[model samples]
Target: MIQLHEQGAYYFDDQIYLESEKKNDAWFDPEAGKKKTMAYKIMQAHNHSGNDRILELKFDSIASHDITFVGIIQTAKASGIEKFPIPYVLTNCHNSLCAVGGTINADDHFFGLSAAKKYGGTFVPPHVAVIHQYMREMMAGGGKMILGSDSHTRYGALGTMAIGEGGGELVKQLLNKTYDTHYPEIVGVHLTGKPKPGVGPQDVALSIIGKVFANGFVKNRVMEFIGPGIANLSVEFRNGIDVMTTETTCLSSIWATDTQVQDYLTTHCRGNDYKELKPENGAYYDRFITVDLDQMECMIALPFHPSNVFSIRELNENLEDILHETEVRGQALLEGSDVTFTLTDKIRNGRLFAEQGSIAGCAGGTYDNICAAANILSGKSVGNEEFSLSVYPASMPVYQCLMDNGSASALMTAGAIFKTAFCGPCFGGGDTPANNTLSIRHTTRNFIHREGSKPQDGQLSSVALMDARSIAASAVNHGLITAATELLQEEKAIPKYFFNKEIYENRVFQAHDQIQKDLPLRIGPNIAEWPEFNALTDDMLLKVTAVLKDPVTTTDELIPSGDTSSYRSNPIKLSEFTLSRKDPHYVPRAKAIREVELERLAGHDVRQTDEGLAAVYGSIQNHFPDFEYDKAIVGSVIYANKPGDGSAREQAASCQKVLGGYANIAKEYATKRYRSNLINWGILPLITPDEIELKNGDYILLRGVRKSLEEGSNRFEAYLVNEDLQKINLGMEALTADEIQILLAGCLINFNKKEVLV
Candidate 1:
């Protein structure tokens, strides 16, 4: 069970006290207590803004995988970056299984190698490691801060404070600029109990996520792990929980370091990087969470989200009612499609049955988790049903260790397929399940379509998240969804993990921070430059191309992952897939509007391109005879209840930008990274505090738009041109001076340089 303390609290002497209970204590001074957190210390070391209120941070290292690096490097190169200022590791894990795109995946890998050689960075070959795993094995250092372009970039368990963000944030570091943000609120995650043997880190993490995500208790706040419970878990167990902190929508996470952390770093050949980190006598937390790991049970997160969690015991007792509710939700997700999904049908003799099982990615593929699972499935078979099991180690070194220790062979002998290091299972790129089947996975997310089921293509599948132990147990039960605890068997005789650095030394291309200035850059045929972007105009018009009524919309819905991500290096081609899954007609509609804007930019009359647009202009002129067409720009916008929830993939915003998207109207943004993505792509993040009626084909016009932003106006007047002019006001949060500059210049690229490359 997890308990949330919404009221502010402080941690002292391994005891948490709310202000109401501890105001009498001498250590209860809020001002001094704020500086006692582990997060504050790490941020203080990296912050160069001269003050703690606003952090202008410089990370010690930055990283990105193939799904992101090509675009990030292209942006930095356009901004006149000559050499990487800090350690930059480009890993090829996300696109390692490239069965969908022809030769493009390998092409991106070669380009990463060329970029690494030319800019003095490190390039890890395909299957070398997933981004976060490689960072853990090599780059994580105690008391240091790292930034990555992947959402799950967490190394807090290793005593490193790491943040996952969009590519623009990485570009700033490459250009020796600062990552600007107000000092984030810190939340103390106090753990005091040891987890039961059958319960893995995913169970503890999902329990916390289920308690916190829906209420936004820790949104955009740093979660600091501390307490007596820290010493009870191994370093890898802490890592499994830390990496999934991204699901709680937290900004970043850090843990108090112990001798175990020192040992972990030492084993990875980084003993000197270890540092003692702990909360001072008293540390203030804006919010607090207490996780009782002793009561943790085998957990499962049903389809559609990682936060929709329940204990396996609870589900078994309430099977019928829960299945009915999930069936209804699944139907909503498959609405207007030919696909039909019913979880109730999976029931066989009153027990739920799934068709596939996966234990992979940064969350589940750690050395400890796999060894435990292999031990559980040592002599048992997964059976010859449709139920198949696959396992992927987090890194090649981990795989090699398993191979050396017979863990890999044990799983393979039990009919479980072993794979190399890859993140495809986490993002729907590989190991996709069959239609209408249920997959029990130990990956990071179970969001709709996250398991690579394309409902648009009349295929649908459901994914439920469980720990590797439960997944292995269910595999032995012919996918009957059994809890690992019911089997009453624990891991025994597991060998110690032996990391093989020779794997990297033999195949990885390490530039060693020495720039190869004379080396020629390699350009892949599929890699394309970004299209030209126009700066903001005094007058702006945005056509509503799509309206989503979902309570929370993820980045996966904005621009899908998997096969569509293959075109990310080419802005034009990638933009074509924008909203392709959620709104199939969005691209054509945006493209049509883009054509009209292109004509306007060329000094041609945009009214001549479309009759409806001509009529709208006439109506605008009729309302105000001085309407200025020359000072205006037209684009598209999308309205969602709350958007940008899941991944930190910048293509969610960049693809929209390349397709003529200028703004997004949402009640609130789900995560900081998504909003940053929007700003980095020059798209305005607009909010509507009150209900506003909107339709797909409606147009909203804002006069003196650029002037309002320049004047620092938080709310601006706008007209919604449905039939008659209707007054509207859209709210905008105050932007940083740099953010405003980037918007005015159209994007990060234009803000950094005046030269335009075609």
Candidate 2:
């Protein structure tokens, strides 16, 4: 549980936290010298190029979740990549259930397993482990750097610096291309004192998250943990807090190591992994955040987002006012939806009432949290009713530990069903609630549709985030929504844990080739090959198939994954539903356009007959009388202010590219990883600011687009014309030197294809 002051507070001298009227300068710009100094030492470790925004460095390993591995592998395969350049772990946690395209999910798993075997990579079967959890237990090490396809890939808690990037960056790694970035400033997240009993790390983290997330205090900055609290917590606890830092959207994280950390690595059979890391005594920090754990209390993040937080006590004491304020804020964020949600509905019985409870995913499905939940739920029946509770272990090892230590029996005996380590419930993929149901969970995200709802089609389910302890505490009372602190005050109970490593020793396939040969992998048929894409042309005629007016469209809406996850490997089948969920009419409109492009490419003379083709062709012919409609390749593109956010799912980009998508037009991209994926797959990364009028359904013709890209020109002339022949000038965004060449070559594959010619 956690407590937060309305005003910002800072811990000074590791003793007390007081209201700090001063700005957060420790991160913005800290004192010049002394222990309070926050700075960057690693930038000194290597040289970089381009704007300081790009960094080039060597990494210890790379990883990807269910959503990203399929396309990352497909891109690498296109680039003639035969094997992984570094240790790559493909975990099937994101799309564990075969929800879409019949067998698409299973096919992707097969592709992963086969690629792992063929390329000597590591493969984690569906529901075996979440991507982040597996990486922490098996891959993290001191002073090492890792790149993952998922944006939440942060391992700095264990002395490892890991980055969550777009799949294009991962493709570069797979193809032996260097990860480019300007070095980042390291902000010291100085921790002091131990978290009081009954309080969890989530409490401390939410407090920090509340302060930093909204203002982008640490955006694209590295969080380096130091100070005395590092000695108090276990490596797993540190990792849990570190993983959530992704919610803050920071670049990466690293923590100072101690004996508890060393012993944890040693117990995992990685004894030599012990290494203590800290910045030089007076290392500079762009900023400093000193967290005093003693004052922390139990916390809860309300529905919709992890950043919506409040102390249970405050909400209970001032329920009416808080709920009213929350309603106003929700209305503002929801944009005029009849989202009839009111926390004050619980005020009738003088208590909070939650309909569902869940303890799952990388944030909550830990050995200690599960063990603690088992202890709380033991000997107490959850009562057969609508308030159901489910517990999911993060990995087989944690599951085995719970069973071996009698924790699993405790929860099961108490009427709670234990489930596999699937990431489904966290996303909309698994355990969806009925319409209007409100579920409370201890998961990574609680975004819209994250708990399984389709708002566009009129179905809405919501999830509120809580720590695992509180989830069980509420379930014990049949969902009266009691806080964990209240239960602890009534009865004191602390569970002991016994680490069990035998299951991993027996079941986990180590990174050895001999052991890998005997393991058989499964593949299904719904998987399809990636379609061929033409290179950037001297001139391009692009038809805007989809235009999203939603302020922020999540990657989930672009390509609904929870349902279509199973079809990740099959290009044609998956493309059919490109914008089906978001805009039900998108597929037919896209198909109509595709037909004209198809006939034009096939050399059919349909210019005079086809209405859709006649207008588009007539406009192009007026500009360059010699231009041939059949010779000009046509494709679709999606425009949004900012896209490619939330999940690291590559299908969001791949599905569009496969359905004849040639580019993405956006004001800015959400993450570096998503945009890179667009470029690698032969889609143009187009940027047309507010000055350009890019109307939906209009044909924007880019003449010498390929040459401009190859020549590394930032600005190029493009003509925007309707079927009526009216024309206007449009411009393209400047690209990095390498980005331009990749576009001209038709994608990374074509670039590599030219290698054979060399």
Candidate 3:
């Protein structure tokens, strides 16, 4: 059903599938010998250098969900922020349910509403909307760039270049500082041909992800959608596929807008916001990926990752081998854990089946996908067996659309319990499965424990990603594995979509026309104030407490979302959970080092921090009369072979920062967003050289570290602060000019403040 060319192909106009050997010759005029490209033209149109390249972006609006907004606004407020400089939408989608964490979850919602009023912002009540969906309907406009705290914040399908970044980045935007970065290469995702009847956008997107992800073909590149296939897909179809582009690790995405896109904006009463954007005729691209939609088929992305993909046809034929390989890979990925996972067991009676099904989150919980699912499961029951189905509409408006179209009635009749918009299932806060159960879902991710099973607790469950139509088709047979393609018989009729914009008009609070007045914000006991941070010292020592070797580590694994949602507004309490879910030993180790920092901050004897440290400081004072323990700062650091892979959660870095983590020493970072989070939180993002062998708990003192950062020194020396306080030479790597300044000032917020005062 699916085929991949061994060599990559490029799209120039409607012609694709040309051999690489002929690519240069076909475009080159032999007599003139002139070669033109898309990237060269587009970059020239938008590119600026040095300080000018750093854009002072002004947003008309800002939107965030429960899992992120509290921390974002808190950070902004801490940086001397008063009155939001722009419109901000605080939506309660991620923590909409008060099921977990008792009163803390709802307490965050009230805090959000109060902050909106106090700061002259907007608030969307719980279950009212998901972050990205609401932004698309109300906030997105042509040629504007939006920044969200959620990682899946790609609204480019609506003609806006939206970026999903850590909360600190949002704080910088609120402070009127530029989003500093060198220009990024733009990649053309040229599409052609209409998708086959049964093929969904997820299948097409999965096909591209499988091909490009591992090779880093599109890493940190802007994917600009173009070509004829844009006309064949609806705006929602493009949006579903666009959100999953985060899996490819692209910097951001944008699409060439058309009348269909205009209609979507108009339907949401934003017609005036529409603007068509396209690259120049001879636009240069760093690389190009050409997709033929007619060749696409119903697909699946297997457990543990979104890029581990295969067609349903290939999976059914090679189930045993694939499952065996997956189990082996899982063991390797999890460091040979005692936990056992078996997918071959589902191959009973010559059919593959899953015990549960879910269609939720911003990626799957859309009106089109849900209604298509209802059409597929119309009269069929999901069965009275263990095979259960749950559906979460992306927003109240989408849910209202489903109800008006009778799709909600059809789904409920087939044993599907509809839920409100919540990001839990996508991040392991909802839809937990029984031990050893396999679930098929259309959510954003299927990372380990993301379905809410902790192997450390002796219970485990796994998830495989499928589109909503195929998920519902599997439910129709009560756990019998089936493809939606086979269910689309000639007699079956798929209903047309009818969107009603009135529901949004009645419910959503549009801040575009709201008047601003100085108001008092409601703060609860659970919402605590931030502790003051210190500036960088001339010398530093960090004890490496935890060492992780996972190929890629997500922020969810580092901090975990399900149980910690309640403590988000309270940093001191929430910091206790930092790395607790992944390491378990991380808390005590981090706390031990934090005690030393606390004592040093109070100008007390080292004994107050640790008796052992007091004795060591005495010895150092004897050697150098000027050596003062009271002036020194002590902190912890974590070493990961490679970490910071998923989500733009600033909490990952903020939690570490709050727990006396001065820096993260890593071989490399998984994504640019994560590294940016570290820098924003004043946690050094250091890259250890290949020859460097850092042991756990080895205290290395970085001498003149602050001076080196300010003086633009790329290489510096470090001393191994042993019992004798002996100095040793250690190598350091260079930092980008902006990064060095950010580190020297302690954080981005401080740097911006310094600039404003100057």
By TM-score, the best candidate is 1
Candidate 2, 1-758: lDDT as tens digits: 22223332333343223335434445322233223322243332432453334556657789987667877777677667765768999898877766655656677777787778766788888878888888878888776788898877887777778888767778877877777655665556777778665566566677778777766677667777777877777676787788888877677787877777777777667768667766553355555577777667677787667777887777778778876787665545444354565556655476667777888888889887887788778889788977888889999888877888788999999888899998878887787876766688878777764566666566666777778877888889888766777777443343444445665566544454533444444445664557666666676778877777655566766777566665666668777767665666666766766776677667778576568668777767876798766666677778877776666666677677667778777776655566767776678766666655555676777677766666667666666666454444334554566666677777776776676467
Total backbone collisions for each predicted model = 0, 29, 9
lDDT of 3: 0.74
TM-score of candidate 1 to 2 decimals? 0.98
Residue 175 lDDT in candidate 1: 87
lDDT of each: 0.89, 0.70, 0.74
Model 3 shows how many backbone clashes? 9
Q: Pick the winner on lDDT between candidates 1 and 2.
A: 1
**Per-residue alpha-carbon lDDT of model 3 for 1-34, expressed as tens digits?**
2233334344445444334544565552321211
Candidate 1 lDDT score relative to the true structure? 0.89
| Model 1 C-alpha lDDT per residue in residues 1-758, reported as the tens digit of each score | 78998888988888898988988988698889999999999999999999998999999999999989999999988887888989999999988976667988889999999999999999999888888899999999899999999999999999999999999999999989899899999999999888877788999999999999999999999999999998999999999999999999999999999999999888888899999889998788888998888888999999889998889999999999998898888778666677777888899888899999999999999999999899889999999979999999999999999999999999999999998899888888888888888999999998885668677888775889999999998988989988888886554755887777888889888888678977867878889988889898878888999998888899998888888878888888888888777788999999888888988888998888778888888888888788887668899999999999989999999998998999999999999999999999999999988788899888988787788889888787788985678888687877888888888888888888853342
TM-score of each: 0.98, 0.86, 0.90
Worst 10 residues of 1 by lDDT: 749-758
Ranking by lDDT: 1, 3, 2
Residue 719 of candidate 1: its Cα lDDT? 86
Clashing residue pairs, candidate 3? 37-282, 37-283, 37-284, 38-283, 38-284, 39-283, 39-284, 39-285, 40-284
Better candidate number, 1 or 2, judged by TM-score: 1
